[model samples]
Target: MLWETSPNSTCLHAQREAFIADVNRIQADAELANARAQLRLPSSRSLVASTKEGKFVAMTSPARLAVSVLVISGCRRHEPAPPLIRPVQTTVIRYGTAGEPVSLSGLVQAQNQTSLAFRIGGRLIDRRVSVGDTVSPGQLVARIESQDAKNTLSSAEADLASAQATLVQARSNEARYRSLLSTDVIPREKYEDAQRQLAAAQSRVAAAMASVRTARDNVGYTDLHSNVAGAVTAKGAEPGEVVQAGQMVLQVAQKGGKDAVFNVPATLMRQSPKPPPVSVALADDPTITAMGHVREVSPQADPATGTYVVKVGLDNPPDTMRLGSTVIGSVTLSPQPVASIPGTALIQIDGKPAVWVVDPATSAVVAQPVNVVRYDSASVIISSGLKNGDVIVTAGVHALRPGQQVKLSPPAT
Candidate 1:
């Protein structure tokens, strides 16, 4: 607003015209920018103009100074350049293949599974093993009442004694009979009857001995015994319960060699080739990753879930990865060639896999979508939407836009 009004008319008129032209140029640039912004288009504010035959006219020679001062001092204002658009140097891959790692999840299971049962039936009088009880091979676990077996043993002893007494009497009578037969004191028919009675008594004794042996076996069967070394995992019958023959009274499990089973899509499981290598981590703590190999892959899928049973056997299994412990398995499908790149380069475009490719000419960034087949430990496999050598944004997606300037950074070692 403060200015000196000069009385020299021609010079003042020339100066006013030059100032007006400068103002027009600034207005034009602002209008152009507003229109481009409305269309969401990008353009640089740098102007390049050349005039070969310049007209002889009074011009604002200090146009830059005038523009800067007016704008900063609020006398005149100029539209600004878009905020410094920096390119994020990202690593990327064109569509290609590489061997990649995969992992699957599973839970620990007892490998040697068995249900402990009784062989013969009787009242369970005593039970030494309960849930969580440990036992060795041939260890007695429980016992049943054997009153009938004891009675049978006593009866068999009486039969044997009676047979022995009858045998002695028969021998004495035979001696007398032999002497009598030489004279006529005793008849042959009487001696023959006595011999037949003694033979019958001997047969009865043999039958009783067999019965005693059977009774002894029955008595032995009344005591429940363990046949393997393991811990009792379950107990269905109590001491007072009368379990029948071959009933599951206890469940024992061996101490080591556990496995994990998980259901996977049928397509993922391959039976023709050897099963894929896999790694596992406990769900409670994923950092504790345990290496494992595929133990089994069921040929069929579960009808309800449409998944095949995939078993993984662990090595150096963590203490936390115990039986019934939840775990996640990364089942490695057979490795195929894939483009390996750092994970920082990945971005999402259109709600799908995407990355920013560096332009060869402009050195600007342009978004490109990609299909991530899988994530290896150090790199990623892209199934599609990339090239083998195309430069991609690795570190900065938020700082990027189309046609943005870039600075190349060294790849990570």
Candidate 2:
């Protein structure tokens, strides 16, 4: 070091000594902090300068300046890091009585279905209508062999004509016998016999006329006619097939009304006894829809499946709701007070259902046991263990632990 000093050298020397004193004070403070914190810091004793130096110089010594910088750096106090806060999504619970809407797959059917059958047993000669064919009232749907019926009708007519001729002859004979009795030419017993013969002939003619009418009806029965305007949904017998009396030949679905038939699970049917109006729509095309009320429900569950058949009669259904078309029926149950939460929030603890609930005061989560009333695809119906204003964790539930600190994300816009 070199000293180029003129007068006032004493003042410069005093300033240098004061700077050294400040550095020494900082070093003492660092040492005290290390002892109190029990931290194993690097020794700062080596950086302490001697109280006396040999001579005053114009420029400071590099070794002494390095010591001052080290002493200043060591004076900083160490602080512990802040606690970890995990960000999670949460939702508030709101209790309400709105039950979830349930949808069922079903088939569109006629409200009034009729099965056309032959009135008498015979070989089916002709089937004029097939499946999906439309027919009007009194339209000929099918025909059975009618040769026997026609022959019976002809025989009845012949008997009727014979009885009529006999009745005429008996009346003439009775009139002639009465005139003879008046002239005392015939006995009274003979006149009574003629009257009895006339009565017998009249009764026979009436019976024969009845037989003719019956035979004619039998012939007409061979040709099956549609009594209602509808479309043929099915065909039971083909041409040349022998069918019995009252055996179905064709099934017609009446055109005026339609029904949506559904096989509903027993659980759902039990939940809502008097179900509200159902909304029915085509399965393939949703735009075609109709409102319906439950018209009938099967008394017993199906043997194959534990479900009840529900028939919903549609009001003024569209033309597209053809018989046998696939449809979807939705039944909205009446409302009941129940709380709903997202399905992701549910967890199992000790084989029981639970959820992670947030503590507003501490911003921590705890596992809460909840009574689940029902389960939906995306949410759960909670009947107990949750109340209004309770906040629950929705996502990342598996990763969370009891009493874990959390920061809630802002609600979605």
Top TM-score prediction, candidate number: 2
lDDT of 2 by residue, 291-362 (tens): 999999999999999899999999889888878899998877667677878999999999999999999999
For candidate 1, write residues 1-413 as lDDT tens digits: 21124444554555566566767876676566556655766547634232355312222336675754454344322566775756456654544343344555566877786776767787888888787778888898888778866777778778777777877787777777778887987888987877787777677778767877877787778777788888887887898888888998888878787777787765455422365556788887889877777777787778898988877778878777777788888754555545767777777777887778888787778888877765756666676777677888778777777777787776433
lDDT of each: 0.70, 0.83
Q: Give the runs in model 2 whose Cα sits over 4 Å from its true position.
A: 1-96, 273-275, 298-306, 337-413
TM-score for candidate 1, residues paired by index: 0.47
In model 2, how large is the Cα lDDT of residue 380? 92
- Can you tell me which runs of candidate 1 are displaced by over 4 Å? 1-105, 152-204, 263-266, 294-311, 335-413
> Residue 309 of model 1: what lDDT?
84
Backbone clash count, each prediction separately: 20, 1
- Candidate 2's displacement at residue 314, Å, is 2.9
* Local lDDT at 10 for model 1: 58
